[model samples]
Target: MPTPIKLSSRNDYESFLEKFDTFLLDCDGVLWHGNTLLPGVREVLALLRQKGKRLIFVTNNSAKSRASYSLKFKKLNIEVNENEIFCSAYIAAYYLKNILKFPKEKKIYVIGESGITEELDLEGIRSCGSSEDDDGKDFDFNDIHPDPTVGAVLCGLDTRINYKKIAKAFNYLYSNPDCLFLLTNDDSTIPYNGTLYPGTGSLVAPLIKSLNRNPDAVMGKPNKPMMDCITNEFQLDVERTCMIGDRLNTDIQFGINGKLKTLLVLTGISKEHDILIKNAPIVPDYYLPSLGDFSELCK
Candidate 1:
């Protein structure tokens, strides 16, 4: 197994950052936690843009669509466009259509939030049930039939998930071993109002755990789909692009998988002591106190 390359000093990190003209950033943890921006994040972004760096905000949170995320960023005073943002919903839709070889018109039962539905519509993938008639009605579990022609189970963040939906997914997955199970991300919970709230990962994880079914694929960070999307959309070489984020499991793993330089900032989930713990698969190429430290490097 390959070990993580560690940069113990600031100079080592600067050397790595100097080579990259394009940056793939994780939004929630790296730039800000919740609604607040990390110190010096704006300045660093501004400086990068001023220096003509190509920056792409890549996120696995499929609860919101790209357009929604773009609007949020603009409200947060970050100058971002829709093209610069790529979410797991978009990636999942693409993977189902092109990678898993699911037909574009294949009808799928999506037990997910609006973002997932929007992405499917964008890709021209048809949903199995409901129109304006079932707008506010709960998802009907009976609608999922155990037909061999049933393409796949596309799981996203469903806030209204219940035992019936989980049972349907489990039954379908059990019956059709070849049927694809595409998950957006595995984040258990998201921080909300100084407390933790169930995220999409939390909702889907139980179904996977109960049925003992690993996903056919996931289309988020640390997975190849998001990385492929970044490369195709940004036209960036993996060697020259850097991924900076605050999570070990997602952001750092994405860099490790993609073979890009990774920077772990302390403003988010993973902390300093977590790095010292040996046998962690998700390790950063460089560690900083925060994004503020990155600003100092730019100076």
Candidate 2:
């Protein structure tokens, strides 16, 4: 358990910036709060780009696809390439298509948003449910009809998650032992616009409790599978990379577990005192009041 150094001054930023050739940034807390961009974020990002740092916007939010995330960058007036974004939805699709070698004849039953289907489509894989099941239909045991073609049940952050989707997903995994159960991210809560809301883990809690099983794979932060996907695709030198985020458990732990440097920001869930809690499970290598502190380096 290493103590985290606070980064504040310009020299601190300069020294910190020199250590990492690549930066993996978490979206929700460090960069923005919902649709609003944080202070000095755009400037610091520009500076990082100017210095030729490889910036990859890694997010556990699976409600949006890569394309959708790119659009969000555009909306924020942030100049980011679509290739620079890696959302859990994209990771899930990559894992299914490349790692699992998901069969062509089989389709995935999605318990998320359109992002899951969008990414799956990009991989030439078929997915059912999601928006199709967003009619708020009530779940009925008599309506249960498992589709043999459905080989997996993929769950993510679904704002429209209902009993119908959970019941249907439950039946698929329950009836077919071969049906793979996957979660884009088991995040219990998400930070948005200065508040926390139920995340993917909350939505998937019902199925997990009912079936007495966890996902075969959780494709997000603090998980090795997602880290493996990024490393294999980018061919990054872990020593020259750093993961920056607001949370201790997911973002910082992801970096630590992946053997990369970790930086904690205070714009989101975990405050500075969290690292001092008794028996804290994870601690970041460095801490900053806000990533905006790096803006002085650009000046």
Candidate 3:
């Protein structure tokens, strides 16, 4: 087996960053906490740009589309184009179209937020609800029947989900085990304005719990699909790409799994002492107090 790679000092991390050409960044915690941008984050981004390093924002949140994120980035004073942002929504669409090889016009049953439906549309996949009748009008429950052509069951963040929808999705999944069970991302909760709101993972977890079925696939950070998409879309060299984030589980694990350098900034979710815990599976290639510290390291 190959020896595990580790970095224990700031010097070691700076040396690694000096050689890297591409930077894969995590958005939520690393760049901003909810709507609040972390201190000195802008400077770090500017410095990276000045040094001619390619930067790509990789996020696991699929509740919103790329266009939504692009607008959010602009509001946050981050200059990111559409191509620079990659979310789980994009990966989910890619997997459904390419990996599963679903037919161009196949109908899908989606139990997700609006973003999930939008992503399916982008791939030219048709989504039908259980209530649709022959004429495409909403049908009563007595007349509702599972559409045999349903290609897959896609679960995302559905704030308006009810028992009826959940039951329908569960029945479809149980009857069609061969059909794909795709999740946008596995985020348990999202931090917003200092409060925790249920994320897609919370919504999907119940279905998994009720059916006792693991997802056939989850296309997000710490997964191979997102990493592959980054490489293919940006033409970045994996060995030279560094992942910088504020979380240990997702961000650090993504770098470790992808064999790229990982930097953990303490300005967000995970703290410095957390890594010192006895059984922590996550350890970053570098540890900084915040993105501000990274600015100094580059100089």
* Best prediction by lDDT: 2
Candidate 2, position 113, lDDT: 87
User: Which pairs clash inside model 1?
Assistant: none
* Poorly placed runs, candidate 2 (over 4 Å): none
As a whole number from 0 to 100, the lDDT of residue 255 in candidate 3 is 89
lDDT, model 2: 0.91
Candidate 2 C-alpha RMSD relative to the actual structure: 1.2
Of candidate 3, the 10-residue stretch with the lowest lDDT total is 130-139
Q: Which rank order by TM-score, best down to worst?
A: 2, 3, 1
Ranking by lDDT: 2, 1, 3
Clashing pairs for model 3 are: none
Q: Which ranges in model 1 have alpha carbons more than 4 Å from their true place?
A: 1-16, 128-149, 175-178, 278-280, 296-299
Candidate 2 lDDT tens digits, 1-299: 76778888888889999999999999999999888899999999999999999999889999899999999999889999988888999999999999999999999999998888999999999999998888865666787798899999999988888778888999999999999999999999987767788888888989989999988999999897788888887978889999999999899999999899999999999998898777678889889999888988777
Q: Give the per-residue Cα lDDT of candidate 1 at 66.
A: 83
lDDT of 1 at 257: 90
The most accurate candidate by TM-score is 2
